[model samples]
Target: MHGLFRWSSKWWPGLIPFAILWVLAAWVSTVPLEAELAANSGTALKSTVLDKTQISVAGRDVSFAALAFSEEGRRSAVASVEAAPGVRLVNDGTRLVAEAKPFVWVAERDNVRVTLWGTAPLPASKARIVEAARAALNGTEVVDRMGLARGAPARFDAATLLLLDQVAKLKDGKIIVQDTAISLAGMARELGGREAIAAALKNLPEGFSVAANDVKAPPYVFQANKDPVAVTLTLSGYVPDNNVHAALVATAGRKFANEKIVDNLKASIGAPSGFSAAVTSALGALSRLSTGTLIVSDREVKLSGDALYEAAAGQIRAGLAKELPTGWTTKPEVSVKPAASPVDSTVCRQLFAQNLAKGRIRFETNSASINADSAGLLDRLIEIAMRCPTTAVEIVGHTDGDGDAGFNQILSEKRAQAVQDYLVKAGLPADRFSTTGYGSSQPIAGNETDEGKLQNRRIEFLVRQ
Candidate 1:
């Protein structure tokens, strides 16, 4: 028995090497099969929407796991691995991603920061959107509060990128994308920003449309500052178009002929109704002031300045609102300047001539009641009269040839008397003034044309030298 056991032990030691070789051969053979199975399964799922895909093989049994975009995609991924040439079975540890009904995304901005929240279709999509927001809002802080989801609309990334462009135009606001619809609400940073965004929406992808756009424009403001020290009328703010801009600049030249115009006005939309008329009238009031500021915001006009004299201040306050269009409002903060030093009758006559040449002292048709539109010019006349307090002045009134001579005579006399009474009421001495009427006899221009007729009616200040 001892001899037989010794012989068996020697044979067992010899067979150990063969056993090792057989195990090595089995392992080496299965490695290639497992690798081939994994490769084939992955290739099958290449066209599927899946995330965090993993495939493992142990003796040709496949373990497939992934987050799929849809239940069908998940089932197909498992089946693809099970059908692989060497795969015995698929473990099928796969799940559909969370679905968002009417998937929504939002980007909100306040004074300090812009925040992006809601669902992204994929991890790659999430990363791309956050990076895009940071790029667009360069200085502004951008926060990401987004997560992964399924059921995003088609062309989701393209639509989101386009909507982000509009966000750059807002001062502060929010933009929302729900499925294929987009909505925006906020205040625009610039005068025409609202329109620009609306125009841009036309280029959005075919499936998307604007559901609601409540973007409001900032105030439509037109401002003018009259600076006596600078001898400049600085016009700044908005105009409806280039034509109104040119007309305002020209009118400023005529009204403030002595002052240089510093035009800083920009052309934009959103001008109030009667914008040109309101601005023109406001500029006239501003011209009468030694220094003033005019602000027209929407339909409201706010004027602040020191008028040339006390009476002029009162007249501007009372007449400015009346000159505005219907539905327009005015707030005048007028004050009287310090009295100017007395001037000789020669200087006073020249001042009166300059004032009359700029504008006319108009009256109601056939009546001596002065038009409110003439208040600024009339105030200028009052200021010049105050400067020459000691001089006796003759106020002469004339008319065009359209009226009956007798009636024209009476009308002209009454007009002259009205001037004298207005000056007396403004604290000027009535004894230093005389009134006269020439009717249509002292015509400076022919009455054949309307332009000539306009020039024929005149009021002359003759300072007694």
Candidate 2:
């Protein structure tokens, strides 16, 4: 009895707490609980869109693919299988499954449960599904894989998928598409760059997104100026950086250069913001390449030697270090992409010289104030000049031979001067510009018809290196 008492005294401290805790737990579980006291399940998109599209917080379907999120925010997103609304209960719970169509899952926290019926549409449909779901239920958890809202379509959701793919590929600034026309809604470099993006997009089977910005002007055409990514290694005396630059050019230049531009920076310096990172990174990469040797080929950059094997590593670090600001360390991987949509000031100038080819802008009767609707295209041109600055140009204005020869000449000069004035006001060097008037002399189309005359009356810019 003495031994027992001693043992109990020594271990009783732990035993008492364990016994009390177990009993309390059991009691809590056994207590009657009201379902009304349970937490609420959030909301979801009740219906599917016949043609799957991006759904914004407003619940309206938009064509954009980008949807921003935060892990601790009001909502989150997931992918799942395709299950139409009011359909069978195939899979449920966190056993989340993914399909080309949609996902299926349930979300719960704080006794609150929200089952996302239309599993977020495949990556493609995600924008629309998430938008719709969030719009319908103010505070909702997004589950991937629930199916059709009552009135939504069950047909092809392919467009949504393609758009998602395009959006994903936007990192390199290349406009992505598989089929549909992807419009440019922002500024671009040379008109060639605009055309390059357009041409690349023209073959896409699925439609694409334009920048929501209003800088996109009409009369979209491609001149094919792919600016090659450039990295110049300044050789000290005669260590031969040519091989290195050559190799670097072979490796990255092809990616950036498409048509006429070998290096976007060299092509034109319109805005420092666009190429600032690229310039810094490229220069840093050039510095790193100084540490390695390259065997330059006609089209390939092959690295050799102990240092050569580490060329990519050296280049990435150097590029990232210089490109990113001090105190900011990069991931050691550098990726530079072209603009998604390019606005070619040079090309726009050309179009203006040619009267927007066919009604690109609506002008007032015999005036040069520019039409209100012409603002979009004009904005695009301004953007191009800002992006590509090395471009030297001549703004030539033309007129139809309807009025007196002298009057026509004066009108043509005023128009050319107007273009020149706008460019100069936008910070272009007046020295880089020269204007000429061809009063009804150089006509592409006939003067017999108003349409032909309109074509003849235009403002064009000849882009000189």
Candidate 3:
């Protein structure tokens, strides 16, 4: 028995390895079934153990990795387990795990709420947001937290009437907003009658309020008027208001007297007391901007200069009955002239050229982009080049020799072509313009000084003449 014990101890070391292999085979056979495991074993596989770590991928409780064998003798043992529907062979506890996600997150979760912010589509931005949310939900019942905001209801002013066709009433210093019923609650400056004050607020959106009037008034007659055709209004007194566009026309006509006549009429006003007349005159000045004159018609008025700006006249017209003043008894004389375009040099230089002078190329700092300040000047040059009939111009580009000659030559050539491209895009004849680069070879100015270097980095225009 002692000899037997010694022999068993000696053999235990060798037997322990086989025992571990057997245990591994048994454990592997119990793995979940999968198709990948089936390919490795003679039969389908059951499950996978990923890298012997917590990170893993498996088909339910069974994925294709159960057919792994620790020894040749155990191959059949693993195969038997792998023969199930979804099984494959693998090494002992060795596997791969996916490392990345492939989808984008639309919301925190399926039932999460969404709220959007931006310019609303005028009337239906709220409804549109709801509809978009419904589409995303795919018929699942979910609460909609989505809504719309229009940058904040714009600040109410005489100009606010132009944006909102409806206006609120300021009555007895109180705010009132009802359909077709409007009022104003402050001392009427230049206001000839109470009805005239109500008429101006008609163009405002359905809300009204009177802020404290702290603006001082002039002691002389002031006048202003608005022109829809030219989309411009003029001011002639100490009226603090500027840009008294079409929106303020009807009600404003009340504070000052406007001739029902088409002829240009003028007048001066008298002051009542304590600058009240001056204040009225200042507010009255805004009325002259209308199509007809708002003659002082004999009153103590004030005067001062007011500011002006371009405004949306259409919005103003929409606020009132164009032919009828909703709250006033005055008539706005309609003009037959068409609206005029605002004057600027952009269109002129694009289509017509008066002449070209001081045409020079301003280079980008160590680069090729034309400076912003130079765009207008360059536009003028292109315009003049267009006037030469049946002519082609060679646009030559040059560079100072600061870098590699070959590179500089290439850059210079590209710069010329860029100019040519711009001209053609600006409606010039592409066929009439040719680009060439001379690198540092053709320097019109010395390259030693910074100012002279700028002159060298230029485009020269030569006509066939």
Candidate 4:
């Protein structure tokens, strides 16, 4: 009996190796089956709207877990797993995603950053919206504060994307979307930005409509700087349109006739009411200054400069406000220039010669009336005449040889008398001035060309020592 027991134990050890081999072979076969089932289950859920999707296979059984956007989606996801090839069973751990009522979303911008908030329908939808905002902002910081939810209306993603575009145009503002309706409130970053956003809303996807649009445009501004040293009047900033732009330039030409006009004005939308009238009146005040600057922002006009004299300064302060359009206001920073010291007749004569060399007194064509463009030069002459208070002056007039000699002589004499009348009216005594006309007989320049004719038709000042 002992010898039989020893032989049986040896045979049982050999059977242990065969049993281990059989178990190993079974595990290897089940591994491939589980993998195949998991792959097919995921493939089945590809068409479903689900978040945090997961699938696990133990042999032929699939454990499915996901948050679904709708009740139908939840049921379909589990059914799809069960129907996958080689999947024998499905353990569903799916729930419907949180539903939002009258789903609302917003994008807001401030000077520092742009923020996006509210509910998103799906994980993919949330990702796409954030990506779109980042792309639109062009490096501006974007803060996302969104939560996942269901119950988004049809084309919710499309509506949200379009609203984000409008948000980009705001300097500081917000845009909101509730279902298929949108509302916007903010200040536009540029002159026409508000209108651009309103225009863009017209092309919203079908079934979408605007609820309220309160976007406001930035200030409409125009500016001019008169530089006495540079001898230039530079115009800059916005104009309402091309017609207004041309009119403003023409007015400047008449007002600042001696200064070079540098036009930097741009045509844009959104000018204040009575913008042209306010600007025109303000420019007139600026023209009376020795050097000045004018800024017209909305309906407010600001003029700052040194006036030619104290009486002129007082007149500007009292008169500018009255000249502006209704509802327009003016702030004038006017001061009188310092008066010049009296000089001898020789020095005065040299000053007169220098002033006339720069610009001549102009008269209307075929008439004795002085042109408006000569006002600036005339003022300079008056100032120089004031410096030589005791000196007697001879005012002489000449004309081009384009007309009959007799008519030219009469016109020239009348023009010299007009100068004497102007000086007499400006508080200068009449006895200190004498008038004469040489007509075309004293021909210092030939009248053959326009340039020579311009030189020939001039007024000369002779300071008597």
Poorest 10 consecutive residues of model 1 by lDDT? 371-380
Steric collisions counted per model: 0, 58, 59, 0
Q: What local lDDT score does residue 164 receive in model 2, on the 0 to 100 scale? A: 28
Per-residue accuracy of model 3 over 18-111 as CA lDDT, tens digit each: 9999899767754543334434443222233112222122442222232112333235443444354443333333222221121111111122
lDDT, candidate 4, at 450: 92
TM-score of 3: 0.27
Tally clashing residue pairs in candidate 2: 58
Residues 170-276, model 4: lDDT tens digits: 99998888887889999999899999999999988888899999999987889999999999999999999999999999988877767899999999999988998
Model 3 residue 345 lDDT score? 39
In model 3, the number of clashes is 59
Report the Cα lDDT for residue 460, model 3. 70
Candidate 2 has an lDDT of 0.39
Candidate 1 segments exceeding 4 Å error: 1-68, 71-95, 111-113, 127-141, 199-209, 341-374, 396-427, 436-460
Residue 365 of model 2, lDDT score: 60
Instruction: Write down the TM-score for model 2.
Output: 0.26
Clashing pairs in 1: none
In candidate 3 the C-alpha lDDT for residue 150 amounts to 21
Ranking by TM-score: 4, 1, 3, 2
**Model 2 lDDT-worst window of ten:** 34-43
Q: If scored against the real structure, what TM-score would every candidate get?
A: 0.70, 0.26, 0.27, 0.74
